[model samples]
Target: MKVFTTTLGEIGNQLSLRLDSKYRETWDNEKGDPIKKTSLNKIKVADLINRLPIKRVKKGELEDECNLLSISETEAKYGRLVNSIQPVTSVGSDKTILNEAEIIVSKLVMSKGYIFTNEESSTDLIGSTELIPYKKRKKDIDLTFIRHLLLLDDYLKYYSGLETGKTPSQKRVNPIDFLQLLVPNVPYDIQKEIGTKIRKLENEMDELKKEIQNRNKIINEILATEFNIDFQEVLDIKKPTTYKKDLLSINNSFDLRFSYKFNAQKYKKLLSKIAQHKVSPLKDFINEPIRLGSSISPSDYDDDNGEAIYISMSSIKNWTLDKDGSRRVSEEYFEKNKVANSIKKGDIIIARSGEGTIGKVALIEDDIDAIFADFTMRVRISNSHNPKYFYYYFCSDLFQLIVEKEKKGLGNNTNFFPNQLKRFPIIQVSLNQQNEIVKKIEEKLEKVRQAEMALVSKKLEIDNLIRKAIV
Candidate 1:
């Protein structure tokens, strides 16, 4: 008989099902939140089996006794929802030490997405929940097959729907459901080779992700250290400025109304710098204004309508627009929200609401002409200055210092208006300097984009290979 077959044909082929309760005992919390030694003393195997936070499973019965092991908390330290396995060979009557018998897996609610390993020892499990332990097999299943199965399109669709509220409930893989799913009964030797290949690919992907995260962290650090500014400093600005024109008021026939104490000396100097750069206020930038408390419906929003892309608090990212991930609104919603004419190309999207991320920023792509969502500010700079340079400047320490000193007045809900933006100073620099800065940024960003594309290619390769394997 052929060992390899379609995934559908693999159903019910030499697989054994074992309920969590059959192999392990649960431990309960004797104390309120943190169990004290006194409370632990009262915990008996029978009394705590159903109530304990830890999960314990027996590997094999030795004579009349069963062996137990504990899983290490390594996965938890990495913010993973799983536990790394560490077996406990020796178990005393009082405390259990993890050794050869335990195959540790995370007991947390989020462990379903992680990979599981039991290469070293395959005994019973101890001090874990949610992770399902398969019945001991004469031929152990390949970890690669398990990993691939976890990432399958069908599995992800089902896993994504899992909900874990407040306290821990069994939000992991349902062993019963999984047992019913089909699995390719590849020979043990072939399975191991496949598992090895899968591990190698997984390592490469993990390395790339780490590299990108590190690069981003470096960028953030440069902006903070070299520029001498902190994120909290920018968050301290309390003044709100309304715009007379720019993004929000451009469509109005009458002069835009805004309150501002524009300093004549500063305005004159700023304008002179603009003239030297050969930039015009109207062409260079517009004031992006966002209203507060607007409701949005996503299903009705479409992007190909030749209207400006609507930017909202949800649309802003560190330096890029999350167009694919953002919620869109129809032109009618823009009219309803009264910000129908507030967005423009080469604008800056600024977050004004949502806790902890109130001052996030994203540069709008020129192709994006969406409207500004409520509680977001779209800052459009004029052609006189480089738009990209202006973006970096907003990210710089000097302007952030101004925001820190000015805008403030509420709980977690402070914001900037048009007048506040108009009054905010843009560093007076020659057009040549602005151009130079923009050129350098474009070059650096292009490299980053290329690196990101490579990652995408790698993902496609792996995904395609898995799809072929299951065929």
Candidate 2:
């Protein structure tokens, strides 16, 4: 364990009466302290930029066609911030007009703050109330440098430590407190040079991301070709609010649910088209029944001294298991629920619920003393099937479309149940053919992964360049 001490004067200087050890410990380990005592001068963030007045306007007040930037659209890419543009009509909330601003930062969740540096554009842009916009008051400092500075790991931690609210989601950094933070007064020439280098790296990173996206498309294309169906057409089918279905159709189906999602005609037609190839139900290849994982409450989490790892939905990403973010449970819980929760080599895990997370699939390649959470489901393929082939099939676009059509729930709590998963149609091919397809797909994906890792290294180099600039 680590310990630190600070005086009452230090707490008073923070302008916050927070007495929590977590906040005090973080404040004591300041990231900008070294720069504060350096020979170089320092500047308050307020002096460097003009905080734009918060303007709240109803949706009807602005033109529907105007570009609107939401907090969700803004993201930190590589070492720089970026945002996507959408028409104002897409959002219903009151917004703040972003006029002549050089940078926009999210006030909520300072640790994962979405910061975007605007470029010269002809389109009118407005943002969400959660965003705080600022313009460069003086031409001496670089806004790009400041954006990267705000994104630094230590600085984000420091800012997050200053957040005030009752709960994690409600926590926000006061704009006044944010503006009072200090930054190194790097010369204009050095700042501009560092910004230029960071931009160059950002461009390279963008290209790598595009390459990875295109390579991923190859897997979908391969699935489409093998199944002899146009995946694009499957995606193009429009979902109507109401659709007609014969009574016999409803009676013949296993699922009695009458929701539009479960009985869409266009989806049925697409499935019929896919049925032209030799297809089998997903249940045919699985030896055991599809099992939903056991739930462990947050109170039961033993992060510091647990015997077994607990894999949540977040642990499964891009068809891979990222154990780094997983939590832990006690030995008692692991042993009691091992039959339903235990995962081993050759097992496939799929996220059964949650928006943006459902349908995510990962194949376990090694035996580990870990169990999946309740929001996920596990499938153990029989000896007759190639596990990798089924894993790739689950990752395919066709399967994802099926998931979209089958998932049922209101709002963001949609779920793809085990029954729905069992009914999914899997295109059947010879074991040798399946192995060949998996081999080719794996070879291509390996190259893409290598390129992705290279871009990660480049981002670190850019970060190091920014760190050196401040010194």
lDDT of each: 0.46, 0.78
- Misplaced by over 4 Å in model 2 are 1-39, 61-65, 77-83, 86-91, 119-123, 167-170, 214-218, 295-302, 305-307, 335-341, 354-356, 373-375, 404-420
Clashes of 1: 50
Model 2 per-residue lDDT tens digits across residues 330-413:
888888888777999999999988889999898899899888888999999998879999999888776887898898898899
TM-score of candidate 1 to 2 decimals? 0.55
Clashes of 2: 0
Lowest summed-lDDT stretch of 10 residues in model 2?
74-83
> Candidate 2: TM-score?
0.85
Provide the global lDDT of candidate 1 against the true structure.
0.46
Model 2, position 367, has a per-residue lDDT of: 93
Query: Mind giving the per-residue lDDT tens digits that candidate 1 earns over 175-213?
Result: 333333334334456556666766666567556654453
